[model samples]
Target: MSEIATFAVGSLFPELIDKEADLNDWATEVERTLDLIPSVSRIEIDPPRGFMSFNLGDATEFKDLIQHAIPIGGEIRFHILIPARIQERIKGWSVSAGNSVEEFLVTIDLSTTYPCAFIIPLGEGVLRPSGAVIVVREFLTEELDKLGSKAAIKLTTLGPSPFHAEFHIKEGDVGEILAPGIRVSRAISSGYSRWTLHYDPEVHESAEAARTVIIQRLGYEFSTFYRIVAHRNIHRFGVAAIEAWVEGTLAFYGGKGLKSWIYRTAKLRKILHDISLEILKVQLGIEKVHKQNERLIEKARDRNSKLALEKELAEKAELGFRDELSSYAEMVGVLESRHSNTTQRLTSFAVSLLGVVVGALLTAALRK
Candidate 1:
């Protein structure tokens, strides 16, 4: 019996706060930073609508950090490629550990927008002879973090919330499964879990049965990451708005006068706009996840796998975008009403002051 095992870890790329820069600029910066690695040899930047692939140079210096269960050969030169717009345009990329010692290659799919992710595939050599998968995952994560610090790119150590990894096992006895071909673990507190796909090599040579499932699940992972990021942004803006509202109300009662109120009100308005954008982002994110989950259900290899996906989708549905939207809308409505009421009061006060001035003028004229 022969078993082929390979895995890849995915994480969200932090939102680059530079508003003025376009996609090209961001990609270029990533390219420049990654090039700083001594082991990275040739790099290709994706065209206006394409991908980048490059061969990994000799990384023997860091070989000691990885506890390999089986000895590896060659200098660990791996090729990496990303598919453009994976769901809509591409079928998905095959990322095997490599055929021979000298010909390792991996295809990583990345999104260009929020919830953008980076996947790093591990060679078969790294996971052979029953290696500790978690330890190797941690090893890669640590090295990525160090690379980020060394290159000034913010690649994740633990990755963003809802990080996902997938294992493809072509041979070997796949432990107990809830389905014919897959076993999905429930996400933990950190939103981390590894889903395994076991394929009978005889039925589908090269494990082609898992391709559609892979694309759909990867799509789900990306959407989940996006949703989390958007949700977090909403919280960030909501907190800012709350602080502004509280400060403004307290300042007015504490005799801080109109200046403080005006400043706080302006700040609150800006925060409200930010909150609105985040709300929209989350809405879009949820839609994507919903669609991908449906696709996963359709392509599920077995009854239990479909049921598991459905259950997961149902749990995700409990998050309820509608409720979130309503809550955010209510918060905005309350703030807007307060602003309107304050403006009306200010206008009335101004009119009353004008009346006092008119009365004084009339009295002075009469005296004259």
Candidate 2:
């Protein structure tokens, strides 16, 4: 399993693209940019949908803008009210008021690199991420002009085409689907409509493969820095690694899956914060181990100093045979010289006493 990087490509693939080149291009970008990590939370798209006005409110207006953006894609409509009715006058029609909030919530799961997409034909979308609501509609409109088509939709992934899903109807009186890709015209049998697709499996596989590569990189990073505790520091490395991998993969596949990449990033930013804290603590412990090593070095230095002092004393006190013998010879010579001087003095004193005794004997004979 470790040997095969793209082992499971051909299996469980969906059809979407025709040409291998196009599929690969799309796949590589989508994979590299998105699906690297499993996000911890769900994403919510809150569009202001006014209620009780008998009218499609702010959310409907923005939905209209997105619809116009798509050249020939499918459409989106909120079935807020059915055919309306008026008072007893019977003059004209009036939309019956309903009690509902003015915002639409679209919940997205961040774990899969899968795609949840639709086209914005009419234009305005105020999409934002995090607790802060951003001016997403204006931001996308400007970018869409450069991209040529106003048609856009969200997807868990763009790789491996035919990545399909069903979303909840925000405010509807009837069931509807916002599908951008090809679907069959078969009528619902019993209660279900069969949507068919003619797609290339390789494109899906290639894109999935690219996503696998990016995810592997993320795993490597998460595991490698699992010990790092601080969220701020983790961002310094983690965010950059994610960005680099995403960019490289996209570039390799011809820059196709940029939209999915943005959506995925928006979803995962907080997950990184949570996991990073756990990892930061782990890394801090490792550093503490390194500090213990320094203490061991200190102990070793103290031991070496004591041994050095003992060695120095032994060298200073060592007795050399040649030098010791010479010192002994010098002491013996001085002792022998003093012995000869004492012998000469004793002999001179004895001779002088004998001379005095002979003179006394001569004086005694003269007296007799």
Candidate 3:
């Protein structure tokens, strides 16, 4: 809380400006100027990350668009912010838009002190966000068209970057962006709600483009953080409460049984308690039922594998046969062949002996 700054026009509710005092150092200046009540505050946690968009059609209408942009809840679209969020880039070379300059110090006045979003058309337009706009061959919107992701695919309808537009919001730097909504840092660095961010000015060497860059960044941050905040706010304040209240109002509206109405109120009370518990679980970062199921699955798998191995060993032991089945079959065939050979040899020997005796007797008769 002691280290952040907020928009100069925001409500007096808990804001980031109380922490910032006077900022001579640009790095600490945004934070220092937090004293400007209602100004945007310091970025709290995580190297910043989120979506960005630019929605000005072209440069010809810069003045009109800038006027519109100053008011809260104004319609802004089709501006380049980060990683291809815009469908079109304001034409850099076209006569309709001014030349896209690279690297310079810029200051567009959207100060709540003046209650205006006027681009300070001074000595030179403040253009540096670290450096002047890097006039690349293609605008972020046009380049993103070539990508296959849904974020890019949806922006194909956006024509081009606006000649007069917001700057890009980035992971670490904060400026040039404003808010009629809430902004939150990444969720990981959750505790101790205070932090600082920095960008290299010397390397960028273009301060004039600061407003456009910061405004673009605000587009990205707002798109990301505000959506989440809105959802949470709605759930916390709208859907959850409305659903509960509707049930109550309907039960009592026009008419109802006295006892039934009492029971309904009691039920509503219990539901609110339960809803609060669920919200608490989410806030506490304990809401992952899927992980709980995965843990159970892992435990079951471990138990099953152990059981399967044990069962296999038990089956092998139950048979308890020492001889291999194929070896025993081969032994049986060999014994049978040896027995057949021995029987054949004995029969042949007996026949041959009988022939010898017959021959001897014939010899004796001839001699006589």
Candidate 4:
């Protein structure tokens, strides 16, 4: 195992940070330093043929949402130096860096704007498969003692586990550092390790070098998280739309219910149309962000870095994205087919109703 020079521990917040007040409330000093991270708009990825664009609706509506057609997040927004009480307990915390010792930087930054997470330095350790996890556990245990359960939970939503960790190694092949052990792979599945390796000292000097990678990594995480939530959202809407169509179709079979049937069917059609459009818009936005990630993969410093990134992207990213998109597309197709069948039924109902009304009117006039 190689000795880690320095490392950082952080967690991901499942929710997107999009409130204007939260965005505007960033500490100026922290914001100035973080302004170095790239903007989502400046990064662009050309969609392949047939990936036609759709309207993102009004700016006001999508401005703070992911549906705004841009990939935003991956920067620090708020931070505070270590508190005196906590500092006293862990003041001299250090971990071995081969023959030497490296002091920990124990400040906490509540990264709020994009890629929302809590970040702190975890000092140095032997870069093993579970090295980061072990260090973070000890660190959090001590922190929980100092901060107290209520306060710690209130300040940040950090749990017993972190979403991911960044291991900074001064030497060794990054690919190997990132590789999962046989036992760990069997336990958690292969090709998906939560810790990542990036060049050290350099990352400390200016995180700019690792910006693309960091953004893309967070992008992949957030997108994957989003896909699950999106599936639920689409599924909920699809089910409701289908229910409406079914109810409307049944109403048509009831006598003296022509107007009610027409109204319900029209409403169902509108709901189906709206949900289908929403699915497409989300798909478009996700594709654009993922394309940017593809470009970022090529920016890796060496062949090893590139290979590591490509492996991660292939194993955990691209397919996941396509799977989510394909699922959404399938839902759309099913809904569209239901809509077509419902329309044909509505047409038949309308024609038969017209015939019945006309015959009754003619019969009444002859009797008069």
TM-score for all models, in order of appearance = 0.42, 0.14, 0.21, 0.44
Q: Model 1 TM-score?
A: 0.42
C-alpha local distance difference test of each model = 0.42, 0.26, 0.28, 0.38
| Model 4, span 193-279: residue lDDT tens | 444344344333433334324443443333333332332333334334444544454444342677865665566566556656755
Name the lDDT value of residue 136 in candidate 2. 18
Off by over 4 Å in 1: 1-4, 12-36, 41-106, 111-191, 206-244, 251-368
Deviating ranges (above 4 Å) for candidate 2:
1-259, 306-368
Q: Point out the worst 10-residue segment of candidate 3 by lDDT.
A: 6-15
| Model 4 per-residue lDDT at 304 | 31
lDDT score, candidate 3, position 281: 41
Please give, for residues 166-202, the per-residue lDDT of candidate 3 as tens digits.
3222233443212212122321222212212223344
lDDT of 3 at 93: 28
Best by TM-score: 4
Q: Is candidate 2 or candidate 4 better by lDDT?
A: 4
RMSD of 1: 13.1
Best model number under lDDT: 1
Q: What is the lDDT of residue 367 in candidate 3?
A: 95
